[model samples]
Target: MSANARTVHPLGERLGKVLPPLMVLGVVVAVWWAVVVKTESAIFPTPWQVVTGAMELVEDGTLWEHIRASLFRVGAGFGLAVLVGIPLGLWMGWVGAAYRTFNPIFQMLRPISPIAWIPVAILWFGVGEVSPIFLIFISSVFPLIVQTTSGVHTIDRRYLRAAANFGVPRSVLFRQVVIPAVLPEIIVGMRIGIGVAWLVVVAAEMIALRSGLGYLIMDSRNAGNRYDLVIAAMIIIGTIGLMLDGITRLLEKLKTVRWRYVR
Candidate 1:
């Protein structure tokens, strides 16, 4: 091979990763613009109309307020889920009796949709931030518990046996051996949980409360038939969710857990 063929350009590598998505996005926008122009429909917005709608929200400062409220609910709910679920899952996995006792209850509740809890949440928390927060929590917690417990159960028995043979204390064994082995799975669970939390918060805000992107979409459509704003809200929600997942994926690159990510 030529010397040039043996070397890779950083800029070219980055462009290789970036160009395909941009090309697809361009195609999508072109098709959307064509459809709007051909149909002459007032309800279905062109790409430019959506941009204009987003700019309007930015100018009024309402966009940031809605984003902040939605993010706060997701963060609070998902944080609570991580704190509670990890320890409970670890205990259940480490103890056979605890696993049998709690596994059935979790299985029963896990299948229930977060949207189904909206009415009860409103009744319990009475139509405020707490109601939506509760809904996000329920949506995220089950997946975390399931994933964490499974991770612990799947750890190699040899590791535990080695630790025991070395006369390691129970707490030390768990802290050093068990936790490091499961860290990757915990990060995966958190990624899934946060996505679910984001989804639930939107629906919860639509039903139980106001002042989020969900509310913006609903209220804009109901009050003014503003399809542009509704679409803008959807785009914002998707973008934020992608960013959240990207943050969690960074954990896979950390040196401590990076081995688990090796193909």
Candidate 2:
């Protein structure tokens, strides 16, 4: 096949894959429009009105400000979780004794909801930015730890045996073989943790901080001038989440592309 033909073929395939979701999105918007037209409720603004509100907020820089604040918190919290959780999980996964010692404590804390920690966070951090940021970290960290542990434990026993047979050092085997094998899992964990961080950060902001998308939604509700902005903020949040997820998928594809021909 010609170069152009090869490129166009994959492009067409990708477009085909994307079309169904686009169609579903269109149908959802249509249903939303129909509902708004039929009900005319003040609480349920039309999609067009929400779009207009989104535009107005963007033009006035209010939307960006809230988005920036939320992003900052999410970024900080997710980064911390990834840095700490991944290593700890790897250690726990690699060593039986470590896993035995830490797994119980991790299980004990994992079930606690992020919201449940709000009172303690506020008491500890005093309703400052730290409190909400800490809440985000708490919500996101456990999933990463669990996933990372699972990833490490799932490594093929044969690979380790082969490395040991070849006189590869324990440290070398882990760094070169074990780490790479589990990287995909770590990335998956990071993606999930980021999503949870985004969710918890917004809730934390709504409760503890004076600014962010969550705070904007609360403020708009209190003002009662327009509910459309609240919906707009929700759309923005969903879009951001999708974008973050897309990045993770892209990374996965990049890592696995060479392996595509193996099987």
- Candidate with top lDDT is 1
Q: Estimate the overall C-alpha local distance difference test score of candidate 1.
A: 0.92
lDDT of 2 by residue, 1-263 (tens): 87876675777889999999999999999999998898877688888999998999989999889999999888888888888899999999999999999999999999989899999998998977788788888988898999999999998899899889999999999888888888788778878888888889878877778899989888888897578998888888889998988876676665543353244
Candidate 1 residue spans exceeding 4 A from truth: 2-4
Q: Per-residue lDDT tens digits of candidate 1, residues 112-180?
A: 999999999988989998988889889999988999999999999998998899899999988888888
Error of 2 at 3 (Å): 16
Q: What are the lDDT scores of the predictions, listed in order?
A: 0.92, 0.87
Clash totals in order: 0, 0
TM-score of each: 0.97, 0.92
Report how far residue 172 has shifted in candidate 1, in Å: 1.2
Q: Which residue pairs collide in model 2, if any?
A: none
Q: After superposition, how far is residue 99 of candidate 1 from its true place, in Å?
A: 0.7
Cα lDDT for residue 128, model 1?
91
